[model samples]
Target: MAEIVLDKVTKRYADGALAVSDVNIEIADGEFVILVGPSGCGKSTTLNMIAGLEDITGGELRIGGVRMNEKAPKDRDIAMVFQSYALYPHMTVRENMAFPLRLAKVDNATVTRKVEEAAAILDLKAHLDRKPANLSGGQRQRVAMGRAIVRSPKAFLMDEPLSNLDAKLRGQMRTSVSRLQKQLGTTTVYVTHDQTEAMTLGDRVVVLRGGLVQQIGAPQFLYDHPANLFVAGFIGAPAMNFLPATLENGSLSTPLGTVALTDRVRRAAEAADAPREVIMGVRPEHFEDASLVDAAALDRGASFDAQVEVLESMGAEKFAYFSVEGGEAHASDLADLAADAGSAGVPDTGSQVVTRLSAASAVAEGQPAKFWFDTDKVQLFDPASGANLTYSAD
Candidate 1:
């Protein structure tokens, strides 16, 4: 219903510790934007600042083209759905949805109409008489959503609203939330630590790190062309694989073997004055079982043999893990990513390269299998700054 803007917004605690620093983002009217990163990356703090739940130490916040820096949470005219359902145990679904209107002293007839409309939109019409205790997890979350929607606020701030649901239920709720947001067309800013949710649920994604803005773009753009080592590792499932390599004569020598740089990559790296020591990045999807590759297509790529340490059959595809000599690529940026993954309980598994192979491929664990990787899809990153040397703005 309205646009929101954070102009150089910053937050600093009394102890001189900064939670968010100089963040600038604009949410167009009815646009759904996501703020995503690892825990303590300041996404939730940024959302809290916007919802007026936290105070800004500097810069400005504007909603619907008006300053909101000094306004209270209720006065900001926004609705927030938190990780917790936070429903009143004593209230029925209908009463919970209508509570905001009741507090505003809206007439009974209008409140009833609005509550009914919200229930219908959320597919909760059948459960309106039920209490939170009687509902399933997903249903209770929908009830929470219904409560927020009845207010018809100018914007919605959601902080990991699907965090508590089971995996299947979370997936279903994601679809439901996407549909509901479009149907209502309210400006939305969602905060999440899940990269899957960040990729699937929003028009644009704003990636943050250590309270700093990393990159802002469409999900696919960030996936295909990350700005730095951290963004490259953070945006994808299984993350992008990094290999240490030396660049000379437009060719790279890596653990995977010698790779002739593609023209696009060569030019970009050359223009950036790339160092001889660089990090080569390749996405999981870019690699495939060599036997499955066409002979004609084989001319455009290269192949190497490695023993598969583990093989996971996923029906549609197979996830094959391999150990390469020289271990995982080492850099400060990469170390930070590893630390985050460890803290989040993601398996370290030592130095493994995860590749998505065709489901029909007969590769098995502990067997030497040839794998082919597309040369043109390779990306080069600066080892020191963690900046993508082969990044293209176009």
Candidate 2:
């Protein structure tokens, strides 16, 4: 296995349009690092650069501590599995898996041993003689993986390898791939636009946008403590709720009402080097019915009132959309809405605040509902800069 490092790396097309800029990251040996972002956000370009498929316009790329700027893909000691499952139509699964070893001129016995080991790991032993056309979509993806596994390269580069499978198959393959990676313990760099895939498959996720690194941390770290509005808005399922609020005295006054800033939240804001009007972000599962919610168990913050505008039943749980009581509601960042939440609208003249509510009780539309967001669960950001104001206790 090898550690991959990109130091101030950049990629610019021949037309001089910058696809990536001063991107620096390090992937440790045996680490599964995921590159996640929206389409056309330079994720694939970054991966291709590491795979030696694209030229680096600036900075250095080091694989196993060796500079690889001018190296060809074949010389990099790496294997790449793409989204399309590029298997040979005429080749049987065994031939496909053994093709790399054959090209390297390995003897027949060694080829058979390696191919059989990979097939056993991937549960493809029964399908070894079958052609790609005869395999199911999920099976074909496994064959693609099996081919990469037999290489035993220094690192593996996978670009959205499961995108072609159906949802159920995708879930199954996700677990399988994660297990296989642990067993092999190879350095891996996976690129994808799906947040679910990034969260489930990565040891550490590198969130990217506009060719810039947003944040790099474990999935839960990014979810619980986002660095900015972009990371906050991009990491979650339903996304964090952002409401306009003003900071006056030691309290944050919003349309929902005034929330007393505890010593912890205040200290964090002071450390961020900003004390201006702020944006309040709350996650969906953070809000519970104030009447029934346990304050002592939560032990961090205050509560607010909301008027229910819409309630969506998601079987096991429910999401409530309601309006805050004060000032008009508007979203300054479109990326937040485009990432997860639907959209912000001026219904009932901006008295509606939409939030995800638990399914423990029935909440009806157009009803005045009392909801409580755990104080510690709230995220604060500078309205001007969109930078998160949470200070890590580190």
lDDT of 1: 0.92
Best by TM-score: 1
- For residue 384, model 2's alpha carbon misses the true position, in angstroms, by 3.0
317 Cα displacement, candidate 1 (Å): 0.7
Cα lDDT tens digits for candidate 1, 234-349 = 99998999988899998889889998888888999999999999998999999999999999878788899999999999999999999888655668788888888884345554
Task: State the RMSD for candidate 2.
Answer: 2.6
Model 2: per-residue Cα lDDT over 108-184, one tens digit each: 99999999999999999999999999999999999999999898999999999999999999999999989999999
Residue 69 local lDDT, model 2 = 96
Q: For each candidate, what is the lDDT?
A: 0.92, 0.83
- Please provide TM-scores, in order, for all candidate models, with all chains considered together: 0.96, 0.92
Candidate 1 displacement at residue 60 in angstroms: 0.7
Cα shift from native, residue 192, model 2 (Å) = 1.2
